[model samples]
Target: MKCEYDKDTESLKIELSEEIDMSTCKTLRNIMDGYIIKYSPKECVLDLEKVNFMDSSGLGLIMGRYNLIKMMNSKMTILNPGDYIKKILGMTELAKDVKII
Candidate 1:
């Protein structure tokens, strides 16, 4: 997993690779949480175009960020997830929670 924070726009765009499973969820969460808190971005965009797999933990991370950002009146979006990931989010009903484009 990799994350790039755009300080100028207070935007955080995370480029997830391979699989977002139990193995990498902690690291992914920590990195994203730190950047989110440090930058206090008005919006967050998670780019999952490169991710090929995801599990429940991955969904948790997305929901956690959404709740966190929503509390601060910020926006969060998930961009370009593949069909597999999209199906997971859809099944979990989290697709409605974010802007997936």
Candidate 2:
């Protein structure tokens, strides 16, 4: 995950690539949490344009971050998730909490 805080937007933009599976999600989650805690951006933007594959762990990561963002009175946005990831999210209720673009 590549994280940067945009002061203009007060958004912490995170760029993710490769696979978000069990093996990588753990590290991804930790890194994301650290960024969230550090920046506390009003909008947490997750860029998944480079992510080729995702599993349940990826969905879990989104949900976990959404909850954290909400607790901080912020919001979460998901960008460029692949079709398969969109399908998985559509099948569940996770989409309700996140704005996907």
TM-score winner among the candidates? 2
How much does each candidate deviate from the true structure in C-alpha RMSD? 1.6, 0.9
Q: Runs in model 1 with CA error above 4 Å? A: none
Q: Count of backbone clashes for each model?
A: 0, 0
Off by over 4 Å in 2: none
TM-scores vs. true structure, each candidate = 0.87, 0.94
The Cα RMSD of model 1 versus the native structure comes to 1.6
- Per-residue alpha-carbon lDDT of candidate 2 for residues 29-82, written as tens digits (9 for 90 to 100): 888999999998999999999998998988888889888999999988999988
Q: Candidate 2: worst 10 consecutive residues by lDDT? A: 89-98
* Model 1 / residue 48 / CA error / Å: 0.3
The candidate 1 region of ten consecutive residues with least summed lDDT is 89-98
Residue 7, model 1, lDDT: 72
TM-score of 1: 0.87
**Model 2 alpha-carbon miss at residue 79, Å:** 0.4
